[model samples]
Target: MDSYKLLINLPDTIVFLSPNLKVVDATDEYLKATMKTREELIGQDFLTTFPDNPSELLSHNMMIVRDSLMRVIATKDTDLLATLRYDIPKPESQGGGFEERYWEAVHKPVVDENGNLKYIIQRTSDVTQNVLAKRAAELEENKYRFMMNALPQLIYTTDNTGRATFFNQKWYDYTGTNPDILATNSWQSSIHPEDLPKVIEKVGHSLRNGTEFQMELRVRNGKGIYRWFLTRSIPMRDENNNILMWVGSSVDVHNTREMVFELEQSHEQMVELSEQVQQAYGKAEAERKVLHNLIMKAPVFFCVLRGPEHRYELMNERYQKLFPNRNLIGQSVAEALPEVAEQGFVKVLDEVYETGREFVAEKIKVTLDRYGNGKLEEMTLTFMYQTIYDENSKVTGIMVCGFDVGEQISS
Candidate 1:
């Protein structure tokens, strides 16, 4: 009896029989379910066990047990047999079907007759939980559809070939056409003819390559006005990376187009301001040249020396009188004058180049042959030579231009 392990204390109902189809034993489960007792079932015949067929479940479900056991023995199959079925009782008052509690029954062969099967066993488990879960999932899908329908933006979809699959109610409400009308094309019957080709081309590319789609096109609104819309789409792909469909949306962009036109108007104003700035620059250039000429002729012994190259770029009238007809431009220290080399000017050049030092000789003792060539240890001159730099901040050259305006001190 324990080998009838499943029958020991089943929560629902169970019955065990012998090879002669006699009720050799019965479970407390079966007795309680049928409103009978163990003694009433012990020696009863199988046909008389459930005398009323207990709602005819015997003849209806006995074939399921016999067929499943035969199918297993015949082919040695292991897949779940489709013989399992549901049974739920209902009165006419309950509308001819059970409210919700679904049941699943299982049957198996328990005994074999002289080299063939004799006794078969059965068990049923409640399936209300599974049925309820499926019902809830369906309700959730409908709820999602309702939310999508409430959106103000026009929603649409297409298959992998860019053929329309879905267009929401809002789209139909705006276009004044049935939702089914656009199955063959997305913007065909709806878009302005001038924008149709480009919209179709972009949508086709996105569908074929599973890419995101975006384009501007004109759509006819409910009022029959052709307005611009920015349509965008994203590809929906399956688990295997194959394109399943394309999901998309469109928004009215007429207001944004007007804003863009205003921005262009502002751009034209900026162009006119740029022309005025250019005219101001030309006037500034003319004044700058006049000032430069004045700086070259002022009564001062000053010149713009070209760094340590010792070349004179711009010299004043005083400096010009001091060195007459001397073209010192493009001349290095050694090539400028023999006197420039005779002095320690070359040493200063090499020192500044190696050490990046600023040399400013505000006062120095020197012999100038403008009066006469006489070497003096301290013929005082007010000279100033300092470093000058270009835009790159490099110490490119030294400015060595100043006047000698001093007399020697009496020793």
Candidate 2:
């Protein structure tokens, strides 16, 4: 077989350039790949035949290719160019436009026996598909990261072995920690010391059994205050049901927890007061004074509705603060808070009074003109309405107690 014919029929896209960078020859594969004939490329200046795409403003294709060829000649050694965007122009029959293309090229110097450069052999492979796929994957990853950072809950991911791999922006903001913590077991340092042991044990159990991990723990904030968080995590599994990773979120529940605790304590106090009032009917005036003092000193809101009309006979400072500068005492529930009445709170109070039973609601949403500004604001509360009784065991009034839990619910 003829050596030149063998080179022309080679499968690899190969081209030969003269010492002056003129295209001397190209394989049949190179001609087909460039959508050109041998007559159009042979003896043509290499740069002139393959110019940079005119539409690409910052195109450095010509400069990059020229530099590599020059380096091969100067060093009398092969030069490699990885992942270069060298678009090819379509033939007139193909509508005459540039087709975006990527390539990896190798320029090997054909040196004389005396070590002088004679010609350069260039080989290239199309890598457009690989480059485009990589870019698409990167864009999807960036979108996922943005969504994670935008969430109100602190989100994180970890390997199946329980090592921390990723954390959203809220986590860093709340804990005041960096990615360096992932290298060590110090990520748990942000957890309250009292809660850390339990967290570790629960996480270890999940890792061993591939079960969901969940717990309510206190986490220290950037300001050094510890707050309660309800955290839950589940394993991401593959087709074979093997755990690949763990995704988790921690929702702040500090406000709701505190409010509930205080509400329980106040409920106990109210129960004691009811017993005292019923037992010491002769000392009613003295017991009323003590009840007034207790209501005033209470941390949560408190109010008393007297008679079947549900008139606000007494209200604590906290209850009054709900509608600042507005008089609630001596007015019926419907009159003082028309919005609350519209939401059927009065009907709830009536049921408690008639049935002689306590009504409890948790994280109930209510719309109120809280500042008396006529602009309605939504709030969440955990509250109770307890029926008050007379010495005759007949229900005469109702006691209202609640705590605003809007912040916790919204979070």
Q: Report lDDT per candidate.
A: 0.60, 0.85
Which numbered prediction scores highest in TM-score against the true structure? 2
Model 2 regions more than 4 Å off? 270-411
* TM-score for all models, in order of appearance: 0.40, 0.67
lDDT of 2 by residue, 101-215 (tens): 8899999989889988889999999888999999999999999999999877789999988989999999999999887887875888899998999999999999999987878
Least accurate stretch of 10 residues (summed lDDT) in model 2? 282-291
The candidate scoring highest on lDDT is 2
Cα displacement (angstroms), candidate 1, residue 409, comes to: 91
| lDDT (tens digit, per residue) of candidate 1 on 269-313 | 544555655476774564455454544543335565565555667
Model 1 CA deviation exceeding 4 Å by range: 1-99, 102-134, 182-187, 269-411
Number of backbone-clashing residue pairs for each candidate, in the order shown: 3, 0
> Per-candidate RMSD vs. true structure?
29.7, 11.8
